[model samples]
Target: MTDEEPTRSAPPEAHAVSPRFAEYTDRLLFGEVWQRPGLSMRDKSMLTCSVLIALNRSQYLSFHARRALDNGLSPRELSEIVTQLAVYCGWPMASAAVSELAPVYAERGIGAEDVAPEPVPPLDADPGMELRRKAVLDASIGAVSPDLARYSNELLFGDLWLHPELAPRDRSLVTLAAIWAMGLQPLLDYQYRRAFDNGVTRDEISDALVHCAFYVGWPRAMAAAMVAREVLVGDDGEDHA
Candidate 1:
């Protein structure tokens, strides 16, 4: 006992976390969730922006609007998300969200340079992609009406989707979220599938829906979850990557 040191205390006992809740977090919330191998946080941000706008959840949109900035999302990208939703989600909702975000932009002192520049698509891009896309539109619209098909293809695919500034993944994520936010479950289903084709993964797409849930509601989250499960299981077995 001359100069013997006291024994160190054992590490704190590991408390048992609820398996039910743990499963929810691990399987539904975190596990492979949002961990789609190649997806980036920025891509998720674009999806969040579109869904929030579509659902008219300006409050959460305002919060994530800042989060997006912190995560390196550019003003231009945010602007595009809001603008793109304007056509589908409506102008009033997008405008309101913009108003909410104005103060955040001011707080961060984001200037012109931090803003995302307009994107440009390759001139020699594949023309066949358009025809293939119509297949998606036709599947979504079916025999009900041509308007939805035209809008999805001509406006969403033709104009906004072609922007080179934003990657196809970003466009797909945003479009899928917008469909979910608008309560267009059928369209959401198709877009969610298409998103995977455009290089988005189930994990990334699910997280976007989760982020959207913070703004929208549980219903939309469930809808996104359903889609994520289907896609993750390789039902389509197609990869946009």
Candidate 2:
């Protein structure tokens, strides 16, 4: 990742301020971990960007957006991600992410219309899972705010998640990143478990946690890593990867 602009990935003054931390950030995080084989660099970029957006860390978003573009995630696809995340991560941060990205798009002469995704029926047509989610929502938050439940069940899952813009696996990865980056550990078990259902592998989850360590900070990433271990690797001592 060659970032012309300063990003959290490789901070310019961190080395002078904290040499060892910087070395580990560069050599260990990027050098060794990122070079491992499971997740593509493109997926890493996308996940990182999503986490940053979720955490409202827009300062670093543009740099990673460039890396995402370099790694083959198209402008339209990114726009799609922003739209999806607006539901899951909230509209303001999603808007902030696009705020940084729009200039990158304009620099390349990519118009808003050019990046808009073609409409489609909701692709998340899993009735069984949909019903299960609604049931859970109804039992919990629905009792408090019925509208929230409807928006979550009827819109987020019924509509946005079903969209074909982002693949199920990619969507799962970014959603997991958002939950993890925000230090929302309770959601980790649920998201990590569902990630497998969405076709994200244990190894890829491992890679993602490591990737998040650099971008979101170690505390958030470490807590998420432990939760992933519990969720992905149970008492059988299995190498499920």
Candidate 3:
């Protein structure tokens, strides 16, 4: 907010565009919503960057990537985040993020070692989780594209999700942000529950979708929220008859 700190703020020229918007951004968005309890600044930064990366908003993403690193996302963790996003958000968006963030990483003196990561041990095995995942994929896509199912099971979830650079909770958060940004309704349905299974709290999930709105837009965020509600509360036992 000062000359000494590269704070998150509206551009100085933003006033010329719309003083009202700039004021709301500074006062309402940053001052209030970002400070909301339960979500740490670091996690919020991670979520924000994930949404931007999913939407391919490279301009804002590069700016926020700087803050994300300062907010405790390591170069390796950020790299892994982009890698995970590749599947859900597509290779092009993730590739573009890598291109844009390269210089930002350089400015921070991030060496090759900083982004090089090793896979960790497998998740403590859970038969239920495995079965549920396979069943859902089989029911949804296996009928049409068995290859996609096999790869999603063997490569995407089996290999990629176990990368140690990013924790499971962070993976769920990043994935949710990306899927929500793209308005992938089916993925949102499952990811909301995946997030909960990974220990992301309900409040955190709500906050994440809310954070995603700024970058991905309201319609997408709203659709994500509706799916989250269905997953969390389950039609509220309302009448279907």
Q: Which of candidates 1 and 3 is the stronger one according to TM-score?
A: 3
Q: Which stretches of candidate 3 lie over 4 Å from their true place?
A: 1-8, 236-241
| lDDT per model vs. reference | 0.66, 0.80, 0.81
Score every model by TM-score: 0.65, 0.86, 0.89
For model 1, state the Cα shift of residue 21 in Å.
Answer: 16
Write the candidate numbers in order of decreasing lDDT.
Answer: 3, 2, 1
Instruction: Name the better of 2 and 3 by TM-score.
Output: 3
In the order shown, what is each candidate's alpha-carbon RMSD? 9.3, 4.0, 4.0
Give per-residue lDDT, candidate 1, residue 42: 69
Best by TM-score: 3
Candidate numbers sorted by TM-score from highest down:
3, 2, 1
- The clash count for each model shown is 4, 2, 0
Error of 2 at 14 (Å): 3.8
List, residue by residue over 1-241, the lDDT tens digit for candidate 3.
2223223477788767998788767765776667777778889899999988888887788888988888888889889989998887889998999899988988889989888876456666467888888998989889999999999998888888877788999999998888887778876777776777788888888777777687778998888888777787776665211
* lDDT tens readout by residue for model 2, 97-165: 878987888887889677766676656477787788789989999999999988888777777777787
